[model samples]
Target chain A: MGTVEFAGVSKTFGGKTVVQALAEVDLRIGEGEFVALLGPSGCGKSTLLNILAGFEQLTSGSVRFDSRAISNPGPDRGVVFQEASLLPWLTVWDNVVFGPKVQGVARSIYEPKAEAILKIVGLEGFKKALPVQLSGGMRQRVGIARVLVMEPRALLMDEPFGALDAQTRLSMQQLLLDVWQKLKTTVLFVTHDIDEAILLADRVCVMSARPGRISREIPITLPRPRSIDDLTNPAFIQFKAAIMTEMRGAHGAH
Target chain B: MPLAGQLSSSLLAFILPVSLIAFWQLSGTNGVIFGGALPTPDRVWTAWVNWAFGTPTFGLNPYVGTWLQNVIFSAERVAKGFLVAIATGVPLGIAIGWSRLFAKLVDPTIQWLRPVPITAWLPISIAIFGIRDFGAIFLITLGAFYPIVINATQGARAVDKNWIRAAQMMGASQAATLWRVVLPAAMPSIFTGLRIGLGIGWTAVIVAEMVAVKSGLGYVLWDAYYVGRMDIVLADMVSIGLLGYLSDRLIVALSGWLLTWHRLQSFNQ
Candidate 1:
């Protein structure tokens, strides 16, 4: 069974000016599937991600996790924000284990898991370092590590590496690809970068702005277990071209 | 290397005060201003030394051998009153900031009462509690409470929306989020309130002591003034300034220690 299902979900911000942030959107992701919601700036891509993560309520329709309606944020769905919003006062280790600790999970169960995840994110030596002490990329790594420690059923990444420099962004993308390949958790990645959508996702769901809706769902035909080296490949270029054309068409329609 | 730099900065800070003291002594000797009521540096020093060390000879010099007792009494009252203000003010401020109902109910009353100066409260304080320690304490607490509560409310209310959302996303309950996320986020502002509140508390204690109570440095100040012992009054004023400065320094040191992470971030940057 699919782990996440969004059926005809629509979100309106307020009563006076009913902004249809999402419109009759329907998506179903099987367990361990990595999908990207690719779109322009105000295309409701993030709105969709927020809904799945239980940060926002739908105005119409419903969202379910394993056939149960998702009402609030929980450890089952871990979200990584664009700014890498790790608590500034907390040490890296504290931020990483915050989820399990708050959920009342015993130290014996989560400590080792947190340690391993920190190692995976290449932040093992920075366990005691404060979030403000680290570089932007390093902070985002801690953000990823924190979510990973929860062993969540799914990941909702809202342009997690969008704030970094181009070099750091590429490295972070590769790091995420490596992590997701091993974990195989269902991911609903939101971003505006066409190349990034083509690089990381199994299928890129391109969205349009203002009363947003999915414009195209283009499947990337790239093989699994991919790496950053695939960026120059012909298949990757083809996928990027397809997404860019779809987005251009969207812009024209608007 | 940084420690040496800090040490030199510390030494440099003393230069201005030392130079001002030397100038004051030089001007006093040269009779640059009123030389009678304004005692010279040496005369003030002699009076302070007598106040500290001289024996009480048949109540002729009440200022003599009474400094420590009065200092203790005043310090104790300020400490007690300021602590009371913090204990009550912090929680009340958090509640007022967190809930609309509480803010609506309590904020107007606080605003109405805040404008009446601490001096105005002296008569009421004396009436209610008589010429007791509680009267002085009451005045001190009332004086300090306003700034502490208001600043704390500002701090609590200004917590970032994202941080709250992040905490909720992690499965933290409402109470846990308030305690863990909100309180910590508001700490810098709360400390600001505390420092301001403490300064007011000291002022209030002195004012209350000057009129309502018969002990403490403020009472001594008033008594010495009436007896034409302006030298003792001047010494008392200096002592109060020194105490206030030291207390503020203590708070700043505490804040620096507690907020090491915040300090390090700014300093390193």
Candidate 2:
């Protein structure tokens, strides 16, 4: 049910000068699989994710989720924004429960689920705190918790930990790895960090900028239940080296 | 300590007005000023006390014990008009901000008409409602509507794009998004509009009462002036100012309570 397919997808943002953001991008994500679209800035990775999330329209080609043509954003696919973007006015509890409340899920049904999700994200004590009152990492935890409460079939995360400090980023990565290990939701993670892409994703699709297209797809055979410690593993290092060379070659060709 | 600091700050703010009143009182000769064209602050105070507390003698003094009544009249008019402005302006503004088609259809008309002052509407209001409370109410509504509507539109338009996208992604219907996400996000802006709109409401009530109505503080202001009761005129002017200030305080307090999150956000920044 979490399957996603992008068939020859092309997107051009039209203005006085038309900018082609993506061209002939073909990709597929299987149910419960983790994929990362790894690229440099301006590689249209975000645009691609936005298209798949139904936040933007592709000019040509098609995107499908669960074998149906993607149209508008829905609870079936949850998106985690880079900024966390928790409703500034809502407390962590309100933000987490926002999805179920809006979808008319009975309070008796969603209340326990929300509490459990918040605990999973390590934000049980922060339920009463407003987003602004929390630190950046705490806010992101609320962000992840809010999405997790929805129990979406697929998770679309766009540079979710890009704004965190080095230490905070590592902790957040570990938290995510722990959570994703249990849930195993189909994930389409976009990131510029090579190690992050390798550590989190099963398959890393390296993308090139300027009419963004996948330059290479490297499969990561890292052991399951991976932790931040695996980042220094020799096997992980080897994969990173190969992907780095692929990125350099792709940039040179451009 | 915080309470003491607040008290001192408030007292500091009153220094200018207090000193101004003192100077005016000291400069007056026999409770008159500007060669008897204006009354001194003391004379205005005396007149105000009489106007507020004097027994009704059924005499020629129209303002005898009528201060509270006139104050109520003006306050009531402002309240009614301001409410109508909020009722219509908020929804209309939200629609204008949310939908491109709605904005294109209605925005130009509002922009064209907004610059036409509330005073300009006085003749039309009187012609229609005829020297009654409705005329003043109409003007007040017109005056308040522009700021409220404009601010609300700006507030709705300024809502973060990701907020809407997030709502949609979370299975919120379009209507639900507008109600829950867009409305709340636009709240700070809506409060801004309400404050500006309310200030205009006071101005409108005075202008309308001076021209189109026979009761209220504004009517008394003009009536006292014509009879050369400059003491009552000054007293009436003070009454209006006090009311305006109080009403504005009410709105500020309301916004403070409703927008606690927004307040925390600014403090964090």
- Which candidate achieves the best TM-score against the true structure? 2
Task: Report the C-alpha lDDT of model 1 over A1-96, residue by residue, as the tens digit.
Answer: 338888998898987876778888988887888889988888898989888888899999999987899889877888999998887778999998
Over 4 Å off, model 2:
B1-7, B30-33
lDDT of each: 0.89, 0.93
The window of 10 residues in a row where model 1 chain A has the poorest summed lDDT is A1-10
True contacts kept of each: 0.48, 0.95
Query: Which residue pairs clash within candidate 1?
Result: none
**Candidate 1 chain B: worst-modelled 10 consecutive residues by lDDT:** B33-42
Off by over 4 Å in 1: A15-18, B1-16, B30-32, B56-60
Tell me candidate 1's interface RMSD.
1.5
